[model samples]
Target: MKSLVLLFATTLLLLSGLKSQESSNISLIPQPVSVARGTGFYQLKDPLIISAPPQNDSVKFVANFLSNRLVNTKGGWVSTEFSESAGKAPIRLQLLPKEDNEIGKEGYHLSVSEENGVLITANTSTGLFYGVQTLLQLLPTAAAGHTVVEGVQWQIPAVTIKDYPRFKWRGMLMDVARHFFTKEQVKQFIDNMATFKFNMLHLHLSDDQAWRVEIKRLPRLTEVGAWRAERTGRWGEFTKPSPDEPKTYGGFYTHDDIKELVKYAAERNVTILPEIDVPGHSLAAIAAYPNLTCTPGTYQVSSGERIMVWDKGTFYALQDNNLCPINERVYSFLDTVFTEIAELFPFQYIHMGGDECYKGFWEKNKQVQAFMKKQGLKDANELQSYFVKRVEKIIQSKGKRLMGWDEILHGGLPPDATVMSWQGMKGGIEAAKQGHQVVMSPNSYAYLDLYQGDPIAEPPTYSMVRLSKAYEFDPMPPGVDSSLILGGQCNLWAERLHTMRHAEYMLWPRALAISESIWSQPAAKNWNSFISKVEHQFNRFDAASINYSRSMYDPIFKAGKDSNDSLQITLSTEIEGLDIFYSFDEMFPDQFYPKYTTPLSVPKGAANLRVVTYRNGKPVGKQIKMPVIELKKRAGIKVKETP
Candidate 1:
């Protein structure tokens, strides 16, 4: 009898362990505000039905979207019904008559149980759509696939969730001017961002490299400026375009394509903000009409690098790329561009590229100097300011607000211009103090193109911005009024990203971190929990055919000197759940190798050290080899031996 009791107790313990594991597996990205787990699971049935209250097109659209997604993934038709009895459907959407101001327009409540099946309620259609997103997240990962996922039981843990975004503008900026992405690729990007509750897509349509949008009146802009000579390898290593070289490696979006994308993003509640970079990054525009530039001559569309020459002090001096502010035709050209831009993008703000204007040309131009003197401008910054003010009036005439980079804040800010702070938090803080709205996109935290992991293992980039650092960023910096801060965005500059896959590999995981940082409350964030959720999201990404980097799983190697002046090698990772192993003598590491529990000293006379990371007893990531001399050199110690 005692033996039987012991066996029963052991069985219960095993079952309890399994249940706990199952609960942990339901990790959701950008975790909901509140979740109440129930005792039993809701087993989804075949011929599932989704229904919503009548006359709510948004709710109806959500139902149809889920139904079609289910049919595509699970190989079963799910019907949508619109009727008063819709509340009885397995999946139901409800819009509360009175809005709950606390939850706001984007918040929702979702409940799943055996008794009620699944029910999502919100004060608005946007809230209902968000609730549907949370509901889809609760389902099995296989449901994320586009094709049939066979042999998987569709089940959702019984739970109730209340979720909402913390900020209004959760955005991502894609620099399409440097490297254009296809319409389908942009749509796919929108789909992925929508899953994380992002609502704004800032399309960088024009820059020094190329112009990526078609304006009906400015045919030469696309015909002459949209194409550039093919340049591969490092961004700044390209040779200047020769007269004989064919400009053949760029593309632009037509008006119809923009309209189609606008409609598609609207269905997902994403607003497209178009940027026509002006004044500074206007080489492409000048290439189309040389008269627009201060120095009028033939200009070729740049491949990927800026024109620079070494000054007397050895600092790189940039050549003139600014539009001729003294010319009356410049304002007319800008008016035409803004008119077409305002028609294409319905977003309120148009980003006027005001950063990196080489003031040398303005100071050198005799006409510009005379205009500055006539206008009582003290310096080149004020001249740029004068230009910005005129552009602001032009943008205002088109019924849109003007936005620009932090450089616009140099001499004097435009009255109604919004500032995108890319250099650091200082510009944002200053802007908010001045009672102007600011978007905090500091490069230290929000530059997604930077290497996220070990620079040696990841793609070459000028700087590093790890996942943890991005997660730790708070858009509303201290001393700044939160009301003036318009949330933040991650920028993906495509100077090095030649393909969509490369862009994807650089975006995700880091983008996931940024989403949670912008959406979730500060106190609710825990790094370990977020890492676990990231691991869970990898499965969904795989099912959805989304490419993402696994660099977080790789070990980050550091070298430092000990008190004895000997070099010590330290290994760590941004995420947990990985076992680090190391081997001396340049051999590959295995599970049997010395498990790294603490920093290891470089062995005397050792030539090299090898490290590998493993998860769940399986080897993951490439074997990292560091020569002993390199380690010593990194530790600031003299290398005894040369490689």
Candidate 2:
């Protein structure tokens, strides 16, 4: 009799452990403000009914979206149309007739129970959409797969989550200029970003490398500038294209494409902000219409080749790319561009790229020099400022606002122009101090193109921005008016990303950290908590077959010299519970190899260092090999470049 009692008790303990595990998994990204995890699960049954309060088409769309996604992803029989009865397995999407003070504009209150099914309520349809996103996340990761998932007992843990974004602007910049991404690819990007609650998309439509959007009034902009000779390899190191090479490696979006995209993004609650680069980075534009430049000479659109030469570390332009700031025709040309742009994109802010304006061509032009002296412009900065002011007026004429890079503040800040600080926080802070709006996108903290892990383990880029740095960013820097600051985003430049998969790989996981920084309360953020959620997110990405970087799990190499003046390599990781194994010999290292317990000093004639990470005696990270010569370079020692 005692043995029977013991067996029953043991069974109960195992069941309780399973329930506890289910109760603990509230790993939603952009961590919600409040969460109450409960025991048991809301096991989904067939004939699931998604009920909603009768309302506008947007609200209906939200309800239909949930049902359609379930059917598409899970291959389940789902029916929409709910009632006051709230029958078995009822998922209710409620848009409150009155506002819930706690659940403000983009926030929602979500509650789930095994007994009552699911209840998602919000003050607006957008909030309802967000609540649905969280609801979807609560399901098994495989439920998100592109192909229909079979034999899944669709279930969600019973929980109560109240969530909202901390900032009004959560954005991502897709640079389609350096390398054009198709309209469909951009749509896929929008879908991914909306999952993380990013509300804005900055479309970089023009650059020296290529033009990515159609200008109906300027046919040559697409006919001549939209195509470029094929050139691959490093962005700034590729050789010049020969005359025999055909310009057939690029494409542009038509006006109809923009309209379709704008509508599609709006449905996902994403606003598209179009960018038209000017003054600088205009080689493609000048290549199309040579008269637009200060020195109107025939030029071809850059083929991803080096157009700037480095003199000791500083860069100087080798071509005339900047728009002629003093030419009347330039303003006329811009007026036409802005007119079409303002009509195509409904977003209030238009980004007039004022970054990297090379003044050499302007300074050398006799006409620009004459105009500057006549206007008493002190320097090239003032001349550029003059150009910016005129562009501002042009933008204003279209019933829009001008947004430019922080460089616009050089000679003087444009009144009412929003500054996007890319160089660092100084420009953003300065702009906010001057009572102008600012979006903090410093390359140091928010450039997605930067390497997210050790250089040896990741693709080549000029520098690194580990996941920790992205999470640790403070969008609301001290000493600036919090009201003037308009949140932040990560800029993903595509000079090296030739494929959509590569772009996606460089974007996510790190973007997840940025989302949390911008959306969650500062105090609510805990790196330990966020990283765990990130691991769970990987499961979802896998199910969706979307590419993402696991760089966080890889070892970060730091080089230094020991007291004996010998080379020393220090290794660490971003996530916890991993054992690092490394080797000094050429052989590959695994869990059985030497465990990393301390910094290692280079032994004599050790040519290569191999490293890998393991958890529970199994390899869990990529095997990375670092050559001794590369380590010397990281240690600030001069190493000969391999020709």
Give the range where candidate 1 is weakest over 10 consecutive residues by summed lDDT. 308-317
lDDT of 1: 0.86
Best by TM-score: 2
Residue 265 lDDT (model 2) = 97
Which pairs of residues clash in candidate 1, taking residues 3 or more apart in a chain or in different chains? none
Pairing residues by index, what is the TM-score of model 2? 0.96
lDDT (tens digit, per residue) of candidate 2 on 1-643: 9999999999999999987788657788888899898867888887788988664678778889899888887776887884444445479888776898877988999999989889998999899999998898898887677768777878889999999888888989999999989889999999998888999999999999988888999999999899998877778878787766799989999999999999999999999999999889999998899988878567998987878765764667998888989889999999999999999999999999998887887888788888999999989999999999999999999999999999999899889899999988999998999999999998989999999988777888887898999999778999878999899988999989999999989998889999999999898899998888988999999998899998888888889888867788999888889999998888899877899989988888788999999988988889999898998987987777879
lDDT of 1 by residue, 1-643 (tens): 9999999999999989977866775577787888788756788887788888878787788888888888888777689998766657888888877888878999999998878899888998888888878878888899888988789888888888888888898999988999989999899989888888989999999988899999989899999889999988888777788977999999999999999999999899899999988788888899898899888677888887647543553433255667889899989998999999999988889999787777887788898899899999999989889999999999999999999999899899999999999988899899899999999899999999999887767777778888888898789998878999999899999989999889989998999989998888887788999888887888998999888988887888889978887888888877778899888867788899999999899776778888888988998767877777777777889855635
Residue 420 C-alpha lDDT in model 2: 93
TM-score of each: 0.95, 0.96
